[model samples]
Target: MSVKSYRQALNEALHQEMARDPHVIVIGEDIAGGAGASGQQDAWGGAFGVTKGLLGAFGPARVRDTPISESAFVGAAVGAAATGLRPVAEIMFVDFLGVCFDQIFNQAAKFRYMFGGKAVTPFVLRATFGAGTRSASQHSQALYPIFTHIPGLKVVIPSSPYDAKGLLTQAIRDNDPVIFLENKLLYDTVGEVPDGPYVIPFGEANILREGSDVTIIAFGRMVHIAMDAANALAKEGIDCTVIDPRTTSPLDEDTILESAEETGRVVIVDEANPRCGMAADVSSIIAEKAFGALKAPIMKVTAPHTPVPYAPNLEAAYLPDATRVAAAARAAFTYGK
Candidate 1:
């Protein structure tokens, strides 16, 4: 195991996976940086430099650079996956998903069911999400919830470098189409990740730092925010258990329900909009299943139902910070006292 940044872990995962499987190919805009340019090739690596060294490792055939078209490239990726090629397609930004919604939701997502369990779309859609980078509303949005609503798509949001490598490895190996989301803000965050390739199965929630007072469930970059809140709460005599439900589609309902029942208070933190987001979804699950074991009302700390603001101040106010999360957890912990 070695200390690696989140970006390094993702890059390592792609490198290891492509080396392991020749059939695995990468296609996206500027993936090879300067594919046809006269200057230094593989310069950009990708929009965020996650695919930097891939062009040098694997030739141009496997590490491809597609035109500036999400609909065209994403649709092509769907077809490629259905035809036996395990393609890893990048969307650059999660906001561009609307351009190829049909290919993803209607085509790739339902291939297995549509073909009576014979089809296997072993494809992974990598996109950057979340706020706090000042990338503005257009380039910044935590849109994983939109993908999670789809039936056949598996949504993954890793909080740390360790989870990023393991979950991405698992997504590449899985037969179904996986929507692996990476928060733009987390790319620089550092954590320990295994040296070689490894896979972490889906639907398993990591109960990070257990406590008896409150249960905190978060995903993506919001997990860090929730952990900070949990740590702050601990100092004030309120212990909180932090749970990261790594994958949203194959959600570990059992672990969440168990944790909620154990603590009897849940503070779900999500960076996406409050309405119809993961926070609301988990809130519903706990309310219905673990309603009887409740000590205080479920608190959902999420962004407002508005587009991400471009201004730094507005964006900071829009995000669910540790203070807000701590306040919610404190409310739950001190209910009826």
Candidate 2:
């Protein structure tokens, strides 16, 4: 198989899904640019050019462009999903979820439960998220927990190129609405992805490295950081098993709890805030379900409970890095005093 970047893998997934299902359609701003302008059509092909050749391949009906209104387009996407089509809408920045939360949380997320499991919204909302890029508070935010708290929606935070493609395909095909958060920094990160269509089940936690010393649970880009720490920790004889729970909503709590029980220690790395975040949620799970398997108090490496800062230094500090993840792992490994 060819080595492809995370961004390319996602693009390929969209291309494959669109080709496979006539019901699967993409809608968002400038998905295929120059709709009414004098310039050539399909000019932009998405803000990051992920949907570049889709317009040429599928034509305008499938690869659609919408106005700069998150509510209108996102609402329309939810409606279309409820009707029959599996729509993949690009919200640009997840920070823009503010304008469309009503449609997402109120409508799409609650439809199945509200309708007594009669309605199925097979929709995927792909949006760029996380700090870095210096886009500031308004643009950069790792807001996964908010969606995770919702019952009827599935939240996917894929850390690698392979996961990106597989999880995205699953999201498009699944009966529930999914919020697929792609880190901007990870767009260029390269990895091997299957050429053919494949699916990664939501509740399965992938153990990146199996170790007995400590278990590190992470999601999205934080998984990479935890894996980095595990690689370095292995040198010092502190082996860490890194688990990426691909989808936060379906959560794979069984796998996480089982790993925690086996290792007797856990370090959770989350890119979001400390309070009421995924780190806290996992820590609580380990505490309740596998409390007897505690070799050390659970450690959480996460951003502070504050808005993402504008400055590069603060932003870097705000985001959990490999160094921070390593320190947390060290704490868990060295605990017992």
Candidate 3:
């Protein structure tokens, strides 16, 4: 095991996968910087430098850069995947999905089902998401819920470097279209990761902290936030279990229900807007299936239903933090008691 940053983990995953499978290729804007310029190549390595060394290792044929048009390249990725290439296309930011929604939600996502189960679109759409860099409203939205809502797309959000490496490997190997959303703020966060390639199975909820008082279900970057809250809650004799549903699409409802039933209280923390977000969806699942087990009402701590603010203070307020999560857990623990 080695301690690595989330960005390094993702970069290593892409490198390992490309080396293992000849069919695996990468396509995105500035993925291989200095496409035709006089300067050095592989300059940008993507907007976050996650795809940096790939161009040198894989060469231009596999690590191809594309125009800024999301529709054309994303559509091309869909075509390439249908033609037997495992393409990992980077979208720069999740908010840019608006320009190429049809290619993802309609084309790549529906190929297998629409073709009588004969098509295998082994495509991974990697995008930087979440609000912490203060990239403003257009670039910082946590839009994982939008992809999670779609049927044919598999969504994976890893909160740590270890999960990022394992889950990206799985996403590349899977025979279905996968939306791999990476929280921009977590790119620099470091965690222990295996040296060689590994895969973390989807739909498995990882229990970060086991507790008896309440259950906290968090996704992506919010997982760390939940952990912070759980640690703080532990001091006040209110132990809490934090579950990270690694893959949002094939959600680990069983683990969620089990924890909810055991704790008899739940506080869902999501970075996305409250309406129709993962927090609401998870709350509904617990309310419907584990209603009798619940001792207190389910509390949801999420971002407001508004665009991410540009100002640092407003952005901080817009995003759910450890303080809010701890408060929600306290509320759940004290309800009706």
Candidate 4:
């Protein structure tokens, strides 16, 4: 085991996977950096430097830098996956999925089912998401829920460096199209990770904290917020259970339902908009499956249905925080009393 940043863990996962299988290739803009520049090559290593050092190890063939067109490269990745390669294509920001939605949702996601289960699209579409960096509405939307809505696509949102490494390795190895959403705010966050590759199976909800009072379900960066809230609530004698549903699509409904039944109260924290987001989806699930276990109403703490503001203060307020989560949990605790 070794302490590593989320960025480093992702880089290591890609490196290990590429070394393990020659067919695993990386394609994205500025991934190798300084591609045609006069200065040093392999400079940028991606927008946040997550792909740094990969270019030097894998070379231009495996660690490829493509044009700024997301549609073209994402389509190419889908094609490559259908043939034989396991392509890990970085879509830059989750907000940029607009240009390549057809390639992802229509083609890549449907190929296996559309072709009588014969195609194995082992393609990983990686992108940075969340709203903390003040990159404004265009670049900072938490759009994992959109991808999760698709049937054939698997969506992964890793909260910690350890989870990032494990979940990414699983996504790369899985014989299906996976949308791996990384929280940009968590790039520098450090945690203990294994030195070698490991896979955190999809659809398993990780229980970060265990308590009997209430269950706090959170996703992506919101998982950290839920942890902070759980810790604060513990100080107030309001113990809480925190769950990180690592994958949103094949959501660990059993774990969530179990936790919700144990506590009889649920507070879902999601960075996406309140309408039809993961929070809403989880709430609906608990309501439909475990309605009899409820002692209080499910409280959903999420962003308003508006574009992410560019201003730092507004953006901070727009995103869900520990204080908000704690307050929601407290409300859930007191709702029926």
Candidate 5:
């Protein structure tokens, strides 16, 4: 019943999870900052200061500070996870994924499948993603698609503070490896999050707003945009339903197909690029399962295929905003109606 920033929610979840389980360890580059430095050992508390107070409470043993080497530290996290530790490693930016993709996709993600369901790698890789902070091409990217493309990995994009807390907790407890994406732009964003421990089951689509005319399916921060668009559409006497499938890997196909069938109109708002991404994936799911119910072709509101631009104006235009999502939903509703 209290409001908290998205970052605080994440911090709280990590704190609570660590308190609940001794095996849950946090390893990352300067996560506790000043790791081996003389100036205040916990000075940095992470690049953006998300883990500020963690070192003081949990100490350096549980809250580790790793070298700049992503492969070594991240690979160590993966190896530790297989050996009975629930390691939550922060990759800082999703862009840095290239350095450690092999460990995730080939090792952690494939452990269970490769071993014929004998292995269980309970690990979480949290990274900041999306464009809005003018972090340029390398630091800012909506790279969920790359993770989504891989098998045995559960991908999560939490749009709000509440979802961030719940989904991250769920990811930590799950048996398989999970890639949790936090939109760098939404760190300061505030929302209500429960204080106690709770876990949101994956593969379940949350229908935030119900409507009769159109179904707007979204993920991560796009879910917030779709909700904004739904509110704007209401003024025009057009009702819209917004659905967020918290986890992309175990996608809730049943909820999506049902929503598509019920509304007979679908608009997918994804922060990722338009090509072979979440947008295309969800559109195809509805197209294949509920094609007959569609009164019009499915619509997708997504970023251009180009890499996230650095310029403020270009970045603003490149990222799909509330207006774009609303317009897309309006078009989908009108075209079908």
Candidate 6:
């Protein structure tokens, strides 16, 4: 294993997977670069450069550049997956999914069940999410909860480079439509990742830290914020456990319930709006199953039920941070004591 940024890890995963399986193909806007725009293969590499070097290795047939149309290309990817190829379609930003969501939720997500288990759509829809860099409301939003709400779509949100590479490999291999979201703030963060491709199974939560006072569950870049909160709380005598539910669809309810029962107080942190979001979903799960072990009402630290703001200060305030997470965890930690 070697240290790699989240972008490098994602690039490596695409390289390894395409080489291993000829059926794997990539279709996205400006992914393979384009004419008169840096003018060569792997030049642009999508909006964030995660798909860099794919064109040089896989060629045009496998690494394709589609027109600037989310609906057309995403629909094409779904159709391609249904026919035979395993297509990894990149949607630049998750906000653009509104244009092609039916293709994802209706067509790609329903093939296998509609065909009575004979059909398989091995499609991986990769998109960048989260609020940072002042992309404004149109570009920065956490929409994983909507994908998770869908019945057949498998949702993945990796918090680190190690998790990104392994979980992405797993998505490419899995025989179902997968929505893999990469947080915009996490692409530059570096971590140790294996050189060879690896797969981390779905429904497995990564317990970043173990403590007894309270359990903090988070998603995507929020996981790091939760980790920071845990470390800070440890100094104040409020030990905490941080869990990252890697795939929200096949959510590791077992791990979450076990941790909630063990601590008897739970705090869920989500970057999305609190209404009908991951925070609410997880809070409901804990309340429904682990209520008997609870020492206090379950707490959810999430963004306000509004769109992400454009101003830097408001944007910062709109997203959940370590201080807020620590505050929530501390509240839960000392509720009765």
Full-model lDDT for every candidate: 0.92, 0.91, 0.93, 0.93, 0.88, 0.92
Q: Is candidate 1 or candidate 3 better by lDDT?
A: 3
Better of 2 and 4 by lDDT: 4
Clashing pairs in 1: none
| Worst-scoring 10-residue span by lDDT in model 4 | 33-42
After superposition, the stretches of candidate 4 with alpha carbons farther than 4 Å from their true spots are: 33-38
lDDT of 2 by residue, 83-123 (tens): 99999999889999988898999999999998999999998
> What TM-score does candidate 1 get on C-alpha atoms?
0.98
Model 3 misplaced regions, further than 4 Å: 33-38
Clashing pairs in model 5, backbone N/Cα/C closer than 3 A: none
Q: How many residue pairs collide in each prediction?
A: 0, 0, 0, 0, 0, 0
TM-scores, one per candidate: 0.98, 0.97, 0.98, 0.98, 0.96, 0.98
Model 6 lDDT per residue over 1-337, tens place: 9999999999999999999999999999989853233455536878889888788777889988988999999999999999999999999999999999799999999999999999999999999998977999899999999999998899999999999999999999999999999999899999999999899999999999999999999999999999999999999998899999999999999999999999999999999988999999999999999999999889899999888899999999898999999988888888988
Worst 10 residues of 1 by lDDT: 33-42
Residue 143 in candidate 6 has what lDDT? Answer: 93
- The C-alpha stretches of model 1 lying farther than 4 A from their native spots are 33-38
lDDT of 4 by residue, 117-146 (tens): 988999999999989887889998998888
183-286 in candidate 1: lDDT tens per residue?
Answer: 99999999989899999999999988899989999988989999999989989999999999999999999999999999998999999998999999999999
Enumerate residue pairs that collide in model 2. Answer: none
Q: What local lDDT score does residue 87 receive in model 5, on the 0 to 100 scale?
A: 94
lDDT string for model 5 (288-335, tens) is 889889988898999998998998999999999889888888788888
C-alpha-based local distance difference test score of model 3: 0.93
